[model samples]
Target: MRTIAALELADCRRIAAAAEAMAAQHQASVSLAICDGGGHPLLVVRLDGASPSSTAVAMAKARMAALNGKPTADQEAAINGPRPALLQLAGVFKEGAVAMGGGLPLLHSDTCIGGVGISGMTPELDGAIAAAAAAALQGQPG
Candidate 1:
């Protein structure tokens, strides 16, 4: 078996911080979540005024990104493409996976180490927050 890099507490902190900053910049009340490569949650934050449901949505987005190694928006596009029926059938096998625009995989050395998810605002803003968090991971050691 081969070993893979994993996210540490510091990494989680950085992701949360960046996501929070993004939310603040956008004036959005949002929820952010981070998950391990295996799709296990590591950290979750709900900004002031964010709805309770945002937390669950954030977690699901993070899991989708980590497990699929791609942005949730891309997954959304795939699921809505011409062959959507086939994609939906496949999605049935990947329970809890969602097609949304607020999740991004955390990459280290071109390998997915974790993921970040954001919710509460529009899908565009949520995706921006998640992207900021994922970008913050760059240049940091795994």
Candidate 2:
């Protein structure tokens, strides 16, 4: 059998903190989510001034990143571009893969271990936060 790394609580906390820091730096209010390899939530936070709907959207983006091992922006591009048909597949997911920016997978040794997602402000700001959070995983133990 092969062994794969998984995210621990500390990793989740670290990612969330990084996301929050990025948002704070930008003076953006957003919701953040961290999830395990299986798309299970580890931590979720909705910052002040964020829309309540953003909380659910953040979680959905995180789940999609974790399960797909891809950034949600790519998914968004696909649906918005030549592959609008992809939306049909999204409908069947337990939480539809949020086809938007602001989600990234946590990779260790090139393998996805989890994901981080952010939402509320502009997609650019949210994606920046998610990128910062995913970067926090660098140098962390498996």
Q: Highest lDDT: which candidate?
A: 2
Q: List, residue by residue over 5-113, the lDDT tens digit for candidate 1.
A: 8999998998898889878888999999999988898999999999999998999889888887989888888777854653553265355656689999999888998
Which predicted model would earn the best TM-score? 2
Q: What stretches of model 1 exceed 4 Å from their correct place?
A: 85-95, 139-142
Q: What is the C-alpha lDDT of each candidate?
A: 0.85, 0.86
List the lowest-lDDT window of 10 residues for candidate 1.
86-95
TM of each candidate vs. truth: 0.89, 0.92
Candidate 1's TM-score: 0.89
Error of 1 at 65 (Å): 0.4
Candidate 2: clashing residue pairs, number: 0
lDDT of 2 by residue, 4-123 (tens): 988888888888888888889899989999988888889999999999999989998898888888999998899899989767755666664676899899999999988888999888
The lowest-lDDT stretch of 10 consecutive residues in candidate 2 is 88-97
**Per-residue lDDT of 30 in model 1:** 98
Query: What TM-score, to 2 decimals, does candidate 2 have?
Result: 0.92
In order, what is each prediction's RMSD in angstroms? 2.8, 2.5
Q: Which stretches of candidate 2 lie over 4 Å from their true place?
A: 140-142
